[model samples]
Target: MHGLFRFLALSAALMLGFSALASAEPRVRVETTLGSFVIELNPQRAPLTVASFLEYVKAGHYTNTVFHRVIGNFVVQGGGYDTSYVEKPTRSGIPNESGNGLSNRRGTVGLARTGEAHSGTAQFYVNLVDNAALDPQPSRWGYTVFGQVVEGMNVVDDIGAVATGNVGPFDRDAPLQPIIIKRVEVLQ
Candidate 1:
């Protein structure tokens, strides 16, 4: 019965492997004034970005933050400003993970940054459409897409449709009426 033992061992190992794969991805629920949406992060593709994001979620850093930038047919960005349009202090920037094979497509969540290649911090954006321009090229770094919206994309779309202008400190593209992020919670 050596062959039978080998078969049972292989089946048990395969089951464990599948379970590990399923649990590797972590989900977070983002509660906002408009509504809530769930995002599933790809740690396998973006380890540093995912870890940093989870740390922010566990620290309640996203509570009361406003989706400061909303570009129709483009992206909705937030997680770095409060209702008053004040910038929230963030930890040092993380490395650019743009080459991780994730694309800045519609419903995908990406880490926002400045002109610097590795300047991504606490702020993030949700793509409203397939933003191929945001993807990395052979010469330059692109935005790091670490997660995607798994539910309530309608809420994201509604947020995208808000009226935006020069509100608060932002010169433009700031929502006239703040779309506040109530909180972000990590799903067990």
Candidate 2:
């Protein structure tokens, strides 16, 4: 009886540990007018950034947002603007996690920000190519790379190929027809 009890206890602990490991990383499916792509977040590398992004995803904050900027061979940025070219309200900026060893490679998603290093809010961009210039340097903070496209990368490429021009406040790289993000759903 004593040996059986010990075995059961160990089994229970192992199951619990496995459960925690399974949920440590979360994946999100971004459904756009063009198609869908899956992003697997690296919470271990950028915990705060991943948490902030998941919070927005759970709240359906990405619905109706447009991929306003489509710079081919560069990036496709969105998650802030609406179909009307209006910026949505976002939570306060999070700390930069660019030093976490993730590179700005193709299919990897990075947080969008102004000149300030910690100004990343809800907006993010996927690298269309290996943008080595966006990587972190000793003198400057680079964009935080939190996740990467695990599936449907071709869909991201299709979105990147869309024609862009002046629209509303943006004088360049705005999709001539809005490439709407229908929704972003977190995968189990």
Over 4 Å off, model 1:
1-18
TM-score of each: 0.91, 0.91
Local distance difference test scores for all models: 0.96, 0.95
TM-score of 1: 0.91
Tens-digit lDDT track for model 1 on 12-93? 9999999987876899999999999999999999999999999999999999999999999999999999888889999999
Once fitted onto the true fold, the runs of candidate 2 whose alpha carbons sit more than 4 angstroms away are 1-24
| lDDT computed for candidate 1 | 0.96
Specify the poorest-scoring 10-residue window by lDDT in model 2: 18-27
Q: Compute the lDDT of residue 38 as modeled in candidate 2.
A: 99
The best candidate by lDDT is 1
